[model samples]
Target: MSEKVEDRIKELEERLASTKVNKATQKSINFIKFQLARLREDLIRIASSKKGGGGGFGIKRTGDAQVAFIGFPSVGKSSLLNLLTEGNTHSKVASYDFTTVTAIPGMMNIEEAKVQLIDLPGIILGAAAGKGRGKEVLAAVRSAELVLVILCFRSDGTINLSDLKTIRMELNNAGIRLNTRVPKIVIKERTRGGIHFTYKGHQLMDADEVKSLMNDLKVRNAGVYFSEPDITPDQLIDFIFGNRIYTREFVVINKSDLMKTPISPEKITEAIGHEHWVMISAKNKENINTLRHNIFMELNLIRVFLKPPREEADMDEPIILHRGDTLEKLCRKIHKRFINDYRYSLVWGKSAKHPGQKFDNLDHIIEDGDIISIYLKR
Candidate 1:
C-alpha cells in the first residue's frame, strides 16, 4: 500500500512539473496538488505504523526561544554555534562535511534574553526523503522559533544557487513553511449541512472549486471562513493537512572571508532573490556581533518588569516574554492564582497611553520595558 501511494505521488508530482500553470490549467493543477497532499498524508500514517524508521533527536527545549542552524554540510553551522553561545556546547568544527553527527544544543544570552541554539547535522540532497538522517535533522528544526539557513560562497566567489534551492525544497517537503504565517482559515465540521464557505478578501478558489476539493478529500460537511486575502490552493490544502509548521527564517551567508573578490551585499541578494540575509565569516569571527544582534532582534522578545502595588518595579529582574504577549499571559506566568484574583493592571511603558495608565483589559498586549502593576483582590 505504501509503495502504491508513493508511485501515485510521484506521478502526480511529475504531471504538476510538466503542466504549464496559467488561468487555463490552474484548477486542474490545484486538483492534482490536492490529490498529492492527501496521498502524502496517507504515506506518513503508513510509515508511522510500521515503526523502526520514525524518530527524532528528542532535545528538551529550554530558554525563552529556540533557534536552529540548517544548511548543507560544511556551511559553517558549527562555527556559528560556537560563536553565538558562551561556550555552552562546542560543536566539532571541521573542514570536511558532516562533522556534526547529532543535534548539539547551546544557550545564547544576549540583550538579557536566554535563547537555545541548536546546531543540527547538515542536511543533504533528498533530505526530505530521509537521506543521511535528514529526517532527524529536520525534525529538530521544526521545533525552532527561527531558522538560520546558512549558505556560503566558494573561494572563487561563485555561489551554487542549486544548493539554496535544494535546501528550500527539502524544508518545504518536510512541512516546514518559512517566513510565512498560518493561513487564516477556520473550518468547523457539521453533521448534516453541506460544505459552506465564505471569504472576506479576494477568494482565489471559487465556491464550486473549494466544494469539489473538500468532497474529494472525504469532507462531506463543513463551514469554512477565510480572513486573509489571495489564498492559494496550496495554502488551503496545507490548512487541511493541519500538521504544517509556520516558522521564521533568514539567510546567513558564511565563509565571506574565503571570497577571492569582494561581492556586494546587493548583488548577493539579487542572486539569491532573498532580502533577509546576513553576511558573516564564522572562521574569522567577522561580523559575528552583527549576526548576534540580528538574531536577538529577529527573536522579537520583550523584557517586562512586574511592579508590586505601591512598590517600585523590579528593574533588575524583568520577565522575558515574546512580543505581543497579553496581560493575561503575563498574569498566568506570574501565578495561576493571580488570574482568579485579578482586578486590574497599571502599565508604564510604550504600550500605555500615558505613564501609569490604569487598564482593565487583560488582553492588553505588553510592550518592551513595560512595568506592569497588577492589583489583585484581597
Candidate 2:
C-alpha cells in the first residue's frame, strides 16, 4: 500500500514538474497538487500507524511559553541551551556529534516569564520520516510555541545554506509550519446536502474545482468559505487534515567567534531573506541578551497586572497572557469561579479607551502592560 502511494506521489511530482503554469493548465495543476497532498497525508497516517504511535517524546509542557532548539548534530545546540538557560539545564555538551540523544528541558527566566527551552536531538535529512529520532524531535517541536533553528558557521566562515534548507524541509515534511498563518478557509458540514463553496475576492481555484476536491475528500455535504483571496489546494488539504502545527520561528547563527570576519546583520538578513536572524557566540555569551529580547518579543506575551477594588495594582508580579487573550480567559485562568461571579473589569493600558477605563465585557481582549482589576458579585 505504501509503495503504491509512493509511486503515485512520484508520478504526480513528475507531472507537476513538467506541466506549465498557464491559464489552460492551472486547474489541472491545482488538481494534481491537491491529489499529491492527499497522498502525502495518507502516507503520514500509514507511517504513524506502523510505528504503533508510541515513539514520541513525552515532555509535559510548562512555563509561560515553550521554545525548542533544532539543528544538525554538534551545531552548538547544547551550548546554546546552556547559555539561554544560564546553566540551569543539564544537557550533555561535547565536541562529538549526537552527544545528546534525548530532549533536554531547560527554563529561561526573562523578566517575570519563565520560558521552557527544549533541546532536542539533531535532525538529519530523513528526520521527518522517523529517521534517527526525527519523529520524536518533531513531536517536541510541535508542542513548542516557538522554534529556534541554530546554524553553525563552516570552517571557512561561510554559512551553509544547504543545511538550513535541509532543516526547513524536514520541518515542513513533519507538518510543522514555521512562521506561517493558517489559511483563512472554513468548512461547515450538514447532514444532507451537496458541497457548496462561497468565496469573496479573487480565488485561486474556481468553486467547481473546490467542490470536486471536497468530493475527493469524502466531504459530501459542506459549505466552504474562502475568506482569503489566495487560498491554495494544499492549504485546503492542511485544513482538512487538521493536524498541522503552525508556530513562530527564528534563526540563530551560533559560534560566530569562529568566523575569520564578522558577518554583518544586513548580509545575514539578505542570505536568509528574513529579519529574524540573530548571530551569537553561545560559548562566549555574546549577544545573548539580544537573543533573549528577540525571543520575548516574538512570543507576543503581555504582562497584565492585577488589582483589587480600591487598591493599587500589583505591578511586581504580573500575570502573563498571550496577546489577544480575552478577559474571560484571564478570569478563568485566575479562578474558575471568577467567571461565574464576574461583575466587571477595569483596565489601564493600550487596550482601554481611556486611562483606568472600566468595562464589564467578558470578551474584552487584553493588551501588553495592561492593569486589570476584576470585580465580582459580593
Candidate 3:
C-alpha cells in the first residue's frame, strides 16, 4: 500500500510540474495538488501503522522551550552546546566527524527561565530517508520549539551552499517547516450546508475553485475561514493535512575565525538568503554571548510579575511567559489548580489601560513587564 501510494504521489508531482499553471488550468492544478496531498498523508499513515521500532532519542524536556542544533558532522554543534550551557553539560567534542552518536541534552538559563538545548546527531545528504540515522535525528528535531541550523565556514572563506540546501531539503522532507507562518485557516464541518469560505482580505483563489478542491479532498460539508491576506493551494493542503511542524529557525555559521577574509553581513545574507543568521567561533568562544542573547530574544519570551491582593508584586521573580501568552496560560503554568480556582485577574502593564485594571477575560493577551494579580473563587 505504501509503495503504491508513493508511486501515485510521484506521478501526481510530475503531472503538476509538467502542467502549465495559467488561468486555463488553474482549477486542475489545484485539484492535482489536493490529490497529491491526500496520497502523501496516506503514505504517512501507513508508515506509522507498520512501525517496528521508534528510532529516536529520548531527551526529557525541562525548560520553557526546546531548541535543537542540527548540521552535518563536526559542524561545532557540540562546542556550541557547551558554550550555551556554560560548560555545565559537556557534549563530546572532537575535530573529527560524527563524534556525538546520540542527541545530547543541555540546559541554558536566561534570566529565571530555563531553555533546553539538544545537540542532535549529524545528518548526511539523504538524512530524511533514514540515512545516517537521519530519520531519528529529525524526529527529535520535530519536537523542538526552535531549530538552529549550523553551517560550516571553511578556512578558505568559502561557505558550502550545497550543504545548506541539502540540510534545508532534509528538514522539509521530514515535515519540519522552518521560519514559515502557519496559515490562519479555520475549517468547521457542518451537517447540512455547502462549503462556505469567509476571508478577511484579498482572496487568492476563486470561491468556486476552493469549494471544488475541498469537495475533492472529501470535505463536502464545511465552513472555512481564512484570516490571512493571501492563501495558496499548497497552504490549503498543508492546513487540511495538518501534519507539518511549523517552528522558528536560526542559522549559525560556525568556525568563522577560520576564514582568512572576514565576510560582511550583507554578503552572508545574500549568500544564505536568510536574515536571522549569526557567524561565530564556538572553539574560541567568539560572539558566543551575542548568540546566546539572540537565541533568548528569538524565543519571543515575556516576563510577568505577580502581585497579591494587598501585598506588593514580586518584581525580582517574574513569571516567564511567551510574548502572546494569556492570563489563563499563566494560571496553568503557576498551578493546574489555579486553572479552575481563579476567578479573574487584575492587570497593570502595557496590556492594560491603567494600573490595577480589573480584567475578567482569561484570554486577554499579556505583555512584557506586566503585573497580574489573580482573584480566586472562595
Candidate 4:
C-alpha cells in the first residue's frame, strides 16, 4: 500500500513536470513532498495513537544545503554574487540603504560546487524584534547553510567592523546565532602580506614563531598552517577545513591593489593573528577560484550531474546537483518513500575512481561530480 502511494506520487510528479507549473504550484509540490515526509515521521505516532489527534505541517530537512548573502547596504552582497556567477544581475548599489526592493537570487559556480547565493535586502539592527527591513532579511539568513558577510572596500579604505557586529546581532534576532552554528569567514583587503590570514585578535612577535606563540596562549589545535609563503589554495583549504576549529570564520583580506607598504606573507599571517586570510579582488578576477575552492572544502559540498537512461546526451540538459548532498539525502530527495525503504543505490561521477559503483543508499557519502543512478526495490 505504501509503495502504491509512492508510485502515485511519482506519477503526479511526472505529470507536473510535463505541465508548466508556476512558482505557486512548485511550492505546492514541495508542500506535498513535505506532507509525505510528515506522514513517514508519523509512522511511530500512528502505531501509538488510539486515533491520536495532533497532526500538523512539518519540514523534511534535506542535505540540500543553501547559502545566503547578507550585510548592510552597499556592502557588495550582490556584487559578490555577480563575481561568483559571472552573471550581470542588478545590484542597484548606492551610498545609502534600500537599494533592492525585492530579494534576488542567482546560481553561482564555485568550481565543482553549484551553490545558490541569494542576494537579500540590506539587514539592519533589530530585525528579529520587528525593526526595519531587518525582519525580511533576517528570515533569509536563517534559511542558509552558510553565510558570506562582505565588508567591502570604501574610498577611505576602512572596512566597518562595527557593521559586522550589528549584522551578527540581526542574525541572532532571526534565531540564528551564526557564531555558534556555522563557520564564518571574513573577506577583506590585505594588511601587508600578499597571502591570506585569519584574524584571532592576537598579536605575535619574534622570528618565524607561530607555534611558540600558540603554546604561550595555551591554544591547542587552533588551526593548521603552511611552513612557507606562496602556498597554493589547496594547501590553505586543507589547513582550514582539515580540522574543526570550534567556532571560526575563514578570513580573506581583499583589495591587494590598494595595500600601502605591502607586508610579506609572514606579516599577512600575523595581521589576522592566526586565522587564515586570502587576498583577492572579486572585481579584478583575482583568486576567486581559490576562494571557491576554500568554500567547497569548508562546507563539505559535493556537486553531481544527473544522467538519464539515454537517447542521446545533450550538453544542454546537464543539471548540476550541489548542497551538502550525501547519498542518503539524494534518496529522500528523489523520493521520500525511497528514504523509508531504501536498500542501496549505484553512483558514478567525476570524483569516483570506480565508474558505475554500487553504494548502499544509507552509507554512501556523495562527493563532487558524482553521476548517480539509484536502484530501488520496486
Each model's TM-score? 0.88, 0.87, 0.84, 0.52
In model 1, the worst 10-residue window by lDDT is 46-55
Tell me the tens digit of each residue's lDDT in model 1 across 145-238.
8998999877777665578889988888767898888999998999978999899978888887788778866789999888888888889899
Top model number, TM-score: 1
**lDDT (Cα, tens digit) per residue for candidate 4, span 249-346:** 44444454554555577764564444444666765778888877765665665556555434322334333344445777666656798777766665
Q: What local lDDT score does residue 16 receive in model 3, on the 0 to 100 scale?
A: 91
Q: Kindly report which residue pairs in candidate 2 clash with one another.
A: none
**Candidate 4: RMSD over Cα atoms?**
21.2
lDDT (10s digit) by residue, model 2, range 1-378: 766876787789799999999867766777787787777666556544433332256676788999999999988999888888987887988988899898888999997998999998998986765578776787678778899999987778877657888888888766778788889988999997798889988988887878877877788999999998978877897888898889878999888887898777788788777999888888889999999999998898889899988999898998888999999979987898999999999898999999889887799999988999899998
- For each candidate, what is the lDDT? 0.84, 0.84, 0.83, 0.51
**lDDT per residue as tens, model 3, 1-378:** 555765676688689999988977998999888887676555444433333322267567778888999999998999999999998999999989899998899999987778999998889986655568676788778778889999977767777656888898878766677889788999999996899988889988878888987887888999998888788878888888888889878999999877887678898898778789888998788998889888988999889999988899999888888998989999999998878887889999899999889877688999999999999888
| C-alpha lDDT of residue 197 in model 3 | 83
Residue-pair clashes per candidate: 0, 0, 0, 12
lDDT of 2: 0.84
Which model is ahead, 1 or 2, in terms of TM-score?
Answer: 1
- Which runs in model 4 stand beyond 4 Å of their true positions? 1-65, 179-258, 261-277, 304-326, 337-343, 346-361, 368-373
All models, RMSD in angstroms: 3.1, 3.3, 3.6, 21.2
Candidate 1 segments exceeding 4 Å error: 1-11, 19-28, 39-55, 197-202, 225-227
